[model samples]
Target: MPDFQKIPSNDVIDTLLKRVSVRKFTDEQISDETLDLILKTSFRAPTSSNIQAYSVVVVRDQEKLDALAAASGGQRHVAQAPVFLAFCADISRIEDALVRNGHSIDSNNLETGLVSAIDAALVGMSAYLVADSLGIKGVMIGGARNKPHEVAHILGLPQRVFCVFGMSLGWPAEAPAQKPRMDYDGLVHFEQYGKSRSGADAKKVVDDYDVALAEHYRGQGRQTTDASWSDDMDKKFHPWLRDDLRERLKELGFDFR
Candidate 1:
């Protein structure tokens, strides 16, 4: 068994620690009040220069949710969730404001892209925490980028706005096992970068986690073929990954020049 440490915080952590990416959800409907609170909390997230160059489109309509699920590689949980939110890196709103004030807005600027993406990420993280606090289970859908152009069309997003990602939210029907992560020693380095430990030390740390994970799954009667973390990493880090985000963003009127 791999040695584990507990979180030090005792402040009513609002069940955030209990959060896991829930792929399965109950049919329970999340109240509009709860949804509003989640969105409000997300908007409160800190942004670069307070530009807030991001927007979220909440999809409650069943047909739209189904379309999103299809776009997301047929992930059924997307349609199953009571709420689906598409978080966008939006510069159009800022550009409009600037233009109205007689300021020339260059939509092609890389700095604008960076600010929007960063703001969206911060807001997404905030939404995740807020939903978790409200006893809502959610999963971040990076797969939303699979067909970014189609997703943008479906969401009616304006030019200079791109879907950063999506989130499926609802109450979990069953508790999911906590996924194991790399050890602190493996991930953290001192002030300066430490010597490469990806040889035996890395293997040992991952091997320990593999055993723990496999055992945990086995106890739940789930059969896992991969016995080591390296095996899982190999599956995840494929070189021929299909990400057409650059082209799609360009098509959606983002000048990535």
Candidate 2:
């Protein structure tokens, strides 16, 4: 059996450490007040230079959700979700601020885009954690980028404002098992960067993890091979993702220079 002793003792910390995305949710409606409170409270998330480079567009309208669902490669959860929020990395707002103050930035730089996206991601996770505290379950929608231009067009996103990702939030209808992560020691590093201490070290970690994961799949009644993780990674990266990503970002004013 997997070790549960490694989990945190604090409830909040444990909650964060064990978080798994919930795609299946009930039809229960979330209160406007609770949503507002979460947004307001989680705005305390740190931002690069305090620029606060994120904005969220909440979609509750069925038509818009359905369009989003189609845009996300038929992710029906987006439509069925009680609330969907498009978290945008908004350099447009910062650019406006700097221009009004007689300062202009070359927003075409990749660092600008990176910071904006990082800011959006930080706040999005903060929002998710806050919602989780209230027993709300949700999942992030990276698939929204599969047809990003349409997503931006549907939401009327302005230049220098793009969806880094989205979120579908509601009460969960099913509780899924917590997925295994890489071994704690395998991931954490100290006293400068280090590789596996010996040639066999790498294989040992991989082989052990493969067994753990394959066993996990079997427990879930999933038919998977021992190399499931590597196989999935190979499938994911053999073809580069989102061929139009650069052009789409360019059209949105992120030239990435």
Taken over the whole model, the C-alpha lDDT of each candidate is 0.82, 0.86
What is the Cα-based lDDT of residue 1 in candidate 2?
79
Tens-place lDDT digits, model 1, residues 39-143 = 997899899998999999989899999999999899999999989989999988788898999996665766777789889989998898888877788899988
Error of 2 at 22 (Å): 0.7
Q: Compose the digit string of candidate 2's lDDT tens values, residues 93-147.
A: 8788889999876546888889999999999988999999889989999988888
> In candidate 1, residue 209 scores what lDDT?
79
**Residue 236, candidate 2: alpha-carbon lDDT:** 83
Model 1 weakest lDDT span, ten residues long: 2-11
Error of 1 at 159 (Å): 0.7
